[model samples]
Target: MTPQQFLQQKLQSRQYAGSYRKLQVQNNLIDFCSNDYLGFARSLELSEMINAELQNYPTILNGSTGSRLLAGNTIYAEDLEKLIAGFHDAQACLLFNSGYDANLGLLSSLPQRGDTVIHDELAHASIIDGIRLSHAKRHSFLHNNLHNLEQKLKAAHGNCYVVVESVYSMDGDFAPLTAIAQLVKQYNAVLIVDEAHALGVFNKGLVNQLQLQSAVFARIITFGKALGCHGAVVVGSNDLRQYLINFARSFIYTTAAPIHQLASIKMGYHLLAQSQLIIDELQIKIELYKSLMGDVPQSSKSSGAVQTLIIGGNQPTKHLASNLQQAGFDVRPILSPTVAEGTERLRICLHAHNSTEEITQLTNVIKINLHVK
Candidate 1:
């Protein structure tokens, strides 16, 4: 067989072996699988704000014509950064195209050569990829294990950067930030927290709510998930922000986020403040879901908004998610390659708009469809 044919044949085997992936759009189901945590994405209030901003800025162009350094540095990006900085109580902020780009830009550029980056073993792909792009030494500790991380930190390493996510995306678990921050202080290392999954859900990310900023080096905030908009912001010292503008290749090379997107983020923040309905509703749903799910089995450490069911294979995870969809819930599987071989799962995403009845329905549907009983 030709080389290409051989490759495709092996790829087919990968699927049969339970790790292949293909996207499917499942419609007509109650959502248990979207990142629209705060219901802001569908809010008429946010859309109207965007419309109003565009109307006011008559001469402002649609696209950020070039990278931020070139032509993309619009007035809106600058203002939005300032707004975020003030809101999050940080000295300065740098906006990236998205959470992925933000992670790529910062993790790839900072923690220079001779520096050590000790990250959570279960950190999102973006975090790992960003570290891969860096010239620093990288290591991963057991997920949320402070002692494990402490041991690694004690081993050979130069100036260390302790990295973790506020709300882990895959398992929906949280890092022990206070302990991690204290350890970071003892080690005299820099602490960086990624608040990607925690932003609007926990309010301004875990770092802000817990008052961990003074102990950490930087906090990564993504507007896409909780803010329910586009783009991300890195909040830290002014020098760090300036350094990213100068050295982060992702920021230097990519086109700046469009003006409307930035405006939408700004609008979303205001909406979050004006009415706590969406966030409160989400908390209620979360509490209800957790109560019904019965302590999350301790075995399932990752059961936040992004819960992992750990059903054991791509086909099983996919099959279970499909069955749930048929039962009127939009659950999606995190297939093998995305996770470890035996840890594929139905990555359920809980939303603020998800009603109590919907939550109960999904829970019943999932357990039954997966034949857990």
Candidate 2:
């Protein structure tokens, strides 16, 4: 077949499976779809703080003209890393353009050919992609199955590495971190936790909240979710930072984030440090949502910002999401292939800015639409 025909075949296959993806513009509706768990993305106060922080770096360039190994490194950037490292209680911090890059760079570069990389099956696509790039032997345990994880750990060879997310994105469930840490320690394997969904939602992150910082080998924290900014950081030991600086293709090859982005990160942390009341407000909304959901059939048990309602088919899941959209709630479907075929769902994200009335309305709409008791 011709190249066009090959591309068409793949596109057709996606369509046949009801998973054809499309780009969408944000609509003016109540948000139950975004990753802005703390609503920092839309916070006027945060925008003002970012603008003020930018003013402090007047002489800094608008763009990082080159990669950090070249001309992009700045005292401001280093200082920001230092600040982040200190906040997370890590020995060092290395910044990446995004969580994907951080995961890719770290996972791809660290494990050698003879080493093993084991991750939770429900770990993000970025984690999977990163492992694919590595030359290491790789395996995935069933999601949060400690026995399966232990089996994998037992069979692992040559500098085993265990990876999991502090808060899983799709299901919004937490990893068995403390137990996993103990298991990894028992097996003498390194542990890496992605705190992408847990960072701003749990203050420093679930790792820090649980005081497991020392137990982890590295923690990947992103600014886009709860922080409502951009970029990511790999918080680890000083040696790991230096090793990645020398070897991580993603970090060494890509241009560093601009001064404005770093300033935004700085101010984001500043706001997050003082956002306990805001965080509590988010928890209140979550509890309110859960209470309203009230054993609704198909609802996933989640305490985090992300909640899922399994609809079981792509068409039905999409239909429910569309109905929610029509009701002025921006709830989105997690379709087949993104999730398993029979487990398609509506992923609802709660935010501090979301009101009790909104949560009540949303739950009521879901219940009425599902015809639940």
Candidate 3:
């Protein structure tokens, strides 16, 4: 029962389950698994833009020094919140250290003791964790199934909140937001959309892209993935903003992100706004990938940066990923219980910088490995 012994047993259990994860250093292989959809992570022009923006704040405070509730709230923080709010066309925006924190704080704080939180079964782990931390009763609808969600909402007793991802991270599919939004209204439930995978892929996100901003109750937008920066923002009403400030423990307890991180987020938005040609190129690459993947087992056909090729089983999926890596691709395997046992996959991320040749080569390699066309 010693703590060290307990930790060791858990690690052993993970190893046995074929889901143990470890940190990996970057390799110079052709990119296929990273979330850097817009290639902003490797954009030298973006780095220079951020550096130039930081120069305006010559006396930059390296860190926020404390939580937003305490010493962390700076003019920069306030301004950034406003800037983000304006960009997202929301009443208010509250910053969190990460997308995880944003979802954690929003779900944990907003839902009350009697409130019911019904989320998609395939929603991100952060949403699940946040729900676990809350006192609200939880239910999970089938992924992107409006009928199932309606049934859940119909039976719910208290304030109901429907949670979904704009673009699901695993299967790389979109939630039926327009349909879901209508359902939420019909059921008198609030809708919370996690736009983590939607930002750079769909201008601002599906909410903004489809003009569903006013329809959604709240949105969680992160900079790390598509923006290729750090931190996240929760877009909602002014009242919700104030409530989360006072009640969201994750936001209240965590140290604010550094000044440089905030500057990077701002610059990232600037780059995204001005990168039409780059974005168009990414779309072209994605189309090329889809056209080339004639016989590939695509989990979903929703158009976005992420695509999952379902390769069943842990060992087999891992082997395929390893083979792809050895063949000079950076693909990674998604093992169970991260995904269902029979649905383990190789998650591929198409980037703006990925050439048509790389896309064709990647698809061919996958076809050859998987014995497809």
Candidate 4:
């Protein structure tokens, strides 16, 4: 059968249930939906800066024509890597097309067959997919449960890698970094932290701020979320960087990200360094989201830049989202099988550009609609 026919047959139940997702192109809504955490994507200040940087190379190629191993390698890409490495205090850095590819490449290639990878159960899908692609014996600990993570660690004796996100994407929560670092240290295991949601936010992630670089084997910091650009970087030792350059198939096989995209990433990095306004705005919005969510049953569970309300069912979650949208809030439903069946939620993303008024109004809309639904 054709792809369309196959999808129609296999996924029709989802479509009929109001859970099938097609891209909804709407603008001008009070956005609590996108991962543009710091609102740099819509920042004209950064846009003008990027345009100015382009002036230095007027004929800068539009796209990177090939993979980094081939003709895609460029001076600016290497420069960006150095800047990233220095910013995060890593010995080196390697760029990937996106956070997903970076995780896939790192997890699939880095861990040896005899190694073990213990990860958090609630990790993002990219991390889970990457671990599946790995050859290591894998185990999962309960979300944010240090004791559970330690129990798994104590039972393992191998070249282990503890995988976690600095800031979890869905729940907007932070990893127990200090405790995890201590456990990994006791086990003599390498720690891999995906700082995808923390980059250009959280003072450049817990790894950088808490001085966990010496304890961490690698960090995956992506530009998509807070930097509001595209692409990701794996930051670690020069050897790890070189190894990925040689063995990471995602980097090896794919066309390199375009020069303009790299330029944008570079520009985004510098903009993050120069400005604290976006960071401040986001903190304000986060506070607003928290304040608005007051007296809600699970309000204390909020973390990172995402505020998730676990509504427990796909149909109701989608209904609540639709209601919020109708009420002028652009919130999205996180449904199964994206999350497990009962953990379905409204994934509200707070942004630097989101005003206190917008946050308060939207969250109130969410509470009213979700409670009713």
Candidate 5:
């Protein structure tokens, strides 16, 4: 078959599955579907802080000239890594351009030949991809099923790494971290927690929040979501950081994050350091959103920023999301194969800046559209 025909077949398959995705422009809808949990993404104070931090540098460099191992390694970048490591209570921190790169770098490089890499079935795509890239044996436990994880751990053949997200992105649910930690300890398996969605929302993440830093072998934190910035960091022991610098292809081969992005990351952390009020406001809004929904099936058990409303079929889920958007709420449908076919959902991301009235209206419209009332 011709190349065009081959691509057409793939596109048709996606269309038939009702999961064809397309680019969408940002709209002026009432916000209910973004990761800016603390409103730092739109913070005037944050913008000003970035500007002020920019002025501190001796020279204005538009880009990181090379990889961190090469010309890209700067005193500023290394200083920020030190600050991040201290803030996260890690021995060392290594930066990546995004969470995808961090996960890809960590998972792909750490699990060696004959090692076993078991992750949650619902782990992020990047994690799964990284596992695929490794020479290790890989398996997945049922999502958040600790018993399944234990079984997998028992049967693991070699050195094992157990992976999970502290807060699962699509489902807006959390892993049973403390229980998982116990399992990891019992099995003598290394644990890796991706706190991409949990960082700003949970102060430092579930690991830091629960003082489980010592329990986990490594943690991946990202700035793109709740931190309202760009980039990610893998926080672990100094040895692991050094190893990643030497071996992680994604990190070793790519250009470093620009100075301005690093500035945003640094300033974002400074804000998080003093953001008890913002976090409190966010908790209040989360409660408000839940109470306003009033028996609407919530996908998240924790008071995290993400919430999912399950709609079984792709067409129905998309239709509901479109209805909510038409009513001025920016609700997005999480369709298969992004999620499973029967578990497609409308992913609602509550924010600190979202008003009670807006939340109420959004839920009421959802109820009216779905005939829930």
Candidate 6:
């Protein structure tokens, strides 16, 4: 068969299964979907701050002209890494254009041919892709299950690496970090926590929140989520940073992020450091959502910004998401392949900017529609 015929067949299969994906532009509606949990993406004040800060570095170009190893390296970029390291209280930091690159670079390079990578089954796609690129033996433990993790750790060969997300993106639940850390310590495994979803939610992150920074071997933090910006950073020891710089293909080949993006990240950190009230506001919204949801059969309880209502089929979940959107709430569905087949859900994200009325209305709409279903 020709390539077009083969591609069409696969696309047809996805469409028939109700799992076909598409790009969409969001309409102006009550945002019940988006990773801007702190509402930083929409902050006019932050934009102003970033613009003001850019004046300090007048010569910085609009784009990073080359990779960091070549022409992309700047005094500002190096200083920004240092600032990020200090914030996370890590010995060193290395920037990546995005969280995907950071994970891909770190995982694909760190574990040698004889090493092992054991990750949680629910870990993000970036983690899986990074592991796939590596030459190491890989295993997946049951999601958040300590017993299963210990079993994998015991069976691990070579240098063992344990990976998990601090706050799972889809479920919005936290990993059993302290327990997992202790187990990793007992088994002499290196712990790598991706703090992509946990950064602004838990202040710095769950690892830093729990004071387990010392226990973790490395951390991947992203700015696109709650920080309302772009790019990511890997926080670890000076040695690990140096090793990635020398050996990671992703880091070596990619163009560096523009100076403006770095400036936005720097200002985001500045705002986050002083925005405890804003953080508290987000918590209040979460609490309000949970209280209103109140053990609804469809709703899955989550303390963080991400919450879900299982619809059990891709078509049904998508239908419900459409209904919510029609009612002026911008909620979206988690389809079969993105989640489990029987657990297709509407993933609702609550932001700090979301008013109490919006949360109430959104929950009421969900409950009413669920009852109708």
Point to the candidate with the largest lDDT: 2
> What tens digits encode model 2's per-residue C-alpha lDDT throughout 142-185?
99999999999999989999999999999999998999999999
lDDT of all predictions, in order shown?
Answer: 0.83, 0.94, 0.90, 0.85, 0.91, 0.93
Output the lDDT of residue 364, model 5.
Answer: 86
The parts of candidate 6 lying over 4 Å away from their true place are none
Please give the distance, in angstroms, between residue 6's alpha carbon in candidate 2 and its true position after superposition.
1.0
Q: What would the per-residue lDDT of candidate 6 be over residues 23-129, giving only the tens digit for each residue?
A: 99968989888999999999998999999999988887778999999999988889999999999999999999999999999999999899999999999999999
Ranking by TM-score: 2, 6, 5, 3, 4, 1
Could you tell me how far off, in angstroms, the CA of residue 252 lies in candidate 1 after the best superposition? 0.5
Q: What TM-score goes with each of the models? A: 0.94, 0.99, 0.97, 0.95, 0.98, 0.99
Per-residue lDDT of model 5, residues 94-140, tens digit only: 99999999999999999999999999999999999999999999999
RMSD values for the candidates in order, in angstroms, are 2.0, 0.7, 1.2, 2.0, 1.0, 1.1
Lowest-sum lDDT 10-residue window in model 1: 295-304
In angstroms, how far off is 104's CA in candidate 6? 0.4
lDDT of 4 by residue, 195-265 (tens): 98888668578798898889999999998888989999899999999999999988899999988888788
lDDT of 5: 0.91
Candidate 1 lDDT by residue in tens digits, 249-358: 98899998888888898888888776566667778788778776663452253435666677776777778877888888888888767787888877778888888889
By the lDDT metric, which is better: model 1 or model 4?
Answer: 4
Question: Can you give the lDDT of residue 245 in candidate 2?
Answer: 99
**Residues 1-373, model 3: lDDT tens digits:** 9999999999999899788999999899999888999999999999999999999989878787888778888888889899889989999999999999999999998888999999999999999999989999999999888889989999987899999998999999889999999999998999999999999888888999889988999999999998999999999999989999999999999998888999899889989989888888888888888878856665445488998888788988999999999999999999998998899998999999888888888888888887786
Winner by TM-score between candidate 5 and candidate 3: 5
Candidate 4 clashes between residue pairs 3 or more apart in a chain or in different chains: 172-303, 172-304, 173-303
